[model samples]
Target: MDVADLAALETGGSLWTWHRGLRDGTAVVFDLDGVLSDAASRQHHLKGPRPDWEAFFAASGDDPLINEVATVLHLLAPELIVVLLTARPARVRTATLGWLDRHQLRWDLLVMRKDGDRRPARHFKQEAVRGVRERGMDVALCFEDDLRNVEMFRSEGIPTLYVHSGYYD
Candidate 1:
């Protein structure tokens, strides 16, 4: 999904929210599934688990629009700290990192759900991201595909770019 797709998720939020209220030395967060990887493009029936299809979920291609965003960030937004915030399980970390490396997407920090943590995605992200912001690491923006997460983030005053995902397709 591209800028227009992000715009489509908006309910009158500023399209250029990235520039508004951003301070120097802030962190920018990117959601992996719909924002960086092609997980959103691939057909997904049931999300959350598939013990038999671990490999399929572990390794995947990049979403075209997000791939371009990575390049733009690498060059123009190098000053801002980059973060990859994924709800994927911890078991997929190695494969996920490999994909990120291949795409040359820089992530200063990576966060994932650990094994046996069964909290809902919205709750998990809300707590984790809130912790980061509370620690004084200013979060300038978040690129996400899940509506549940977008609502939580925006409610906390963090600007979000909502990308279209197969979950809603």
Candidate 2:
């Protein structure tokens, strides 16, 4: 997504709520599905040629918490701004928010894909990180499950930790 397109996308959460954290000059980014949440149960819907995206995302509410990553999130959130950047469409914001709450996950900002956006996850996510940087918040680190996204961020000089969930291979 381009600058204008990105600006048009719906972003949840309040940056102001975590503005103090940003003063430290860095933010930590976390991807939703397959990273913070185990998306294995919903992976089936993404199989075959015409993947049932709606079904895949619709079933996300049932995803189990990825405890290890959650522990890391909890550890960093109190010191650094935590941004939840996901390729999930904004249409599922309510369910997504509920899922976060259910897991007791706290994030300063939530960035979701624009509805009907057909861009690849790598493209969408890279732009989201760029947007975060554009706000003067340096991304100190990122946690992602997709290999493509991990490589993308690393290529851009952003430190990204790959959490394997077997989604990309």
Candidate 3:
């Protein structure tokens, strides 16, 4: 892979390396909340969980797609099996789908936190990515903004591209 090409991808605050690995046709996993949608820092505080998720999910308030994120998504749309792996509870599936529809964001798979799985966010995400791999999909890269999750993924041998959070002030 060309160093310059990799550096160019980082220009959008994303270390995108999927295109280089696409020769073998691999899937790409993306964290939806902070990377694609400005949900974490803008919609609610990161330190506390939202008191009412059903209500929060039902509302269209947390629907803004981060700039430049869509460009990468569109670029990857044609050849990649875009998997939107999120830590969102399964109970919010309906509302989440609504939000995705409103934003016109489509995914080949939408992995969510399973009921009764109270694992930390980092572990939960690692499992989500692993679930995809278990199904025989070669995950070329993961786009995420959480450093903790990035470390977890890297620990498991999955390469991660640090997605600069739009949530930061």
Candidate 4:
């Protein structure tokens, strides 16, 4: 299916809430940066006159493994509610949402960190997970690539999938 198909399925309005399972009810929380997209590299800007941000991102998107994982999540975890918790500021929400739209990746909720926060990114993510839990849903798993974030989620008793990267492992 394409992005349009996924968007139509989302249908907005409390999509973040858990859907009752055939046997057991559970929720699936996702990290925005490394889990859903190649957002890790976007944190840094390409330097020099020949810098090609689009090309750089396109190169990363060529990975077959990442696409495979995304497809698996879309199929196997269709019933599980998905949330994209990111430290990205609200200013980039449009671009981020556009990226999600283009990729056809459907998420129930998108939580972006607000500015004027003194806490670390990991702490912010941990708090977001807590908020999700407070909404009366069981977070079955949280997918993140940064080791710091993985540790933060683990400390909160949340299971996490650490996406391995060369620099951050």
> What are the per-residue Cα lDDT tens digits for candidate 1 across 1-169?
1222211111111111112132335888888776677664454535456633344454454444366556656775567867667677666655665676577666666667665566777787887687567646789999898999999999989999887865655
Instruction: List candidate 3 segments past 4 Å from native.
Output: 1-25, 40-61, 166-169
Report the Cα lDDT for residue 85, model 3. Answer: 76
| CA-only RMSD, every prediction | 10.7, 6.1, 10.9, 6.8
Candidate 4: the clashing residue pairs are none
User: What is the per-residue lDDT of model 2 for residues 1-169, given as tens digits with 9 covering 90 to 100?
Assistant: 1122122234322112231133435789899888899999889888989899999999999899999999988877465778888888888876887787778777766778787878898888877788778777889899998888999999989989999999878
State the displacement of the C-alpha of residue 4, model 3, in Å, after optimal TM-score superposition: 44
Q: What C-alpha root-mean-square deviation, in Å, does candidate 2 show against the real structure?
A: 6.1
Each candidate structure's TM-score, on Cα atoms with residue i matched to residue i, is: 0.72, 0.85, 0.72, 0.69
Ranking by lDDT: 2, 3, 1, 4
Query: In candidate 1, which residue ranges exceed 4 Å CA deviation?
Result: 1-24, 40-42, 45-56, 59-65
Model 3, span 1-169: residue lDDT tens:
2333211121111122222232334788888777888775335533365455544444534668776876788777576788777777666665666676677764666667764566787877766666567657889888888888889888878788988874434
Clashing pairs in model 1?
Answer: none
Give the candidate number with the greatest TM-score.
2
Best by lDDT: 2
Candidate 4 lDDT, 1-169, residue by residue in tens = 2333233111111122222211224767676556666544543444566655454444344222357457757875566776677666554555666676568776666666664454777877776777677766688888777899889888989888887653353
- Scanning candidate 4 in windows of ten residues, the lowest lDDT window is 8-17
